[model samples]
Target: MAMTAAPPRVVATEAALALIARLLARHGPLMFHQSGGCCDGSSPMCYARGELLLGEQDVYLGDIGGQPFHIGAAQYEYWKHTQIIIDAVPGRGGMFSLEGPEGMRFHSRSRLFDDAEWAALVAQQPACFQADQKL
Candidate 1:
């Protein structure tokens, strides 16, 4: 048999996707981009409402804590080699983290913090926040 490799699939289930759709439905469009960051040339960031660089691109959907969200196409395109999946654990909520196919890692977006997960997410992204629900 010819051997090959498949890219990582979202770990979340259908229910999660449904939830994400609901959460994002009211929050406006899910946007993504590459920005200069501490570790390297750039990092992936998500916005609840804003103009997207690419108006038409495939968006990734995944759910966390019964809330749905999106990952922008441009962001995925840049980091496809790194596993791109929503970390939908309960307390962790839903956030994007880069798990290198090897070992190193990085993250962006708000940690899937329900009314409780806020503290840690804040610590990680103190200045990056959404005021009036506009991130």
Candidate 2:
């Protein structure tokens, strides 16, 4: 039997996509980094592409609304078993995020992958799963 591809590790809700489109129109290309810090740092921060300096410990999870999404490697270790869903809500966004002034904030929701999904993900990206094994 042919093996199907694993599902994406990240996705955006329609509300989040709408906000992203608006941000893109004003800021050009964009990117997202899930903060591992306290308070606002736990939220997803959106920035103009290349605005944030990525370190060696950042892991690229996937894309949402055509923008790349990433998280700290340490954070990724704690979240590798779940799928990240980006949603937009009424609130002040992360202080550094572009959406703060727009009266909406980006939020992260997650669900754990099932056994088959986890197996497929591991089969599809052995290297990534292998690194998690070391944690």
Candidate 3:
């Protein structure tokens, strides 16, 4: 039997994709970091590649629209069981995010992973979650 690919931990909606395309055309390359609350209120902040410094505390969730997406390690511990859905919403984005001037923000929505998806993800990256022992 052929092995199926695991579902992505992060994904973007069509509007978010279109916005990312626009940002890419103007900015060259982009990246996303899901804010861990506080001033940013958990919004997904978009930046030009290399704009923000990522340290060991950041976990690379996956890519959306070819841009890498990451979340803080502590936040990931809470969010690991859910699929992160990136959406474009009408609003001023995080003060530091590129989308602020565009009148749209990258928002995060999520749904808990069903048992099958959770199993596949665990099987695919057993080492990554070993510390949590979520299995």
Question: Which candidate number has the best TM-score?
Answer: 3
Q: What digit string (tens of lDDT, one per residue) describes model 1 on residues 1-135?
A: 432332222333454344445545656544434443444434443345444444456554443434333445665445433433442223222134222221222233322223323333233333644332221
lDDT of each: 0.38, 0.91, 0.91
The TM-score, computed over Cα atoms with residue i paired to residue i, of candidate 1 is: 0.30
* Model 3 per-residue lDDT tens digits across residues 4-27: 567999999999999999999999
Residue 95's lDDT within candidate 3 is 92
Question: Ten-residue segment with the worst summed lDDT in candidate 2?
Answer: 126-135
Q: Model 3, poorest ten-residue lDDT window?
A: 126-135
lDDT by residue (tens digit), candidate 2, 18-113:
999999999999999999988686899999999999999999999999999999998998889899999999999988899999999999999998
Off by over 4 Å in 1: 8-19, 38-43, 48-50, 54-80, 88-135
Clashing pairs in 2: none
lDDT for residue 23 in candidate 1, whole number 0-100 = 42
Clashing pairs in 3: none
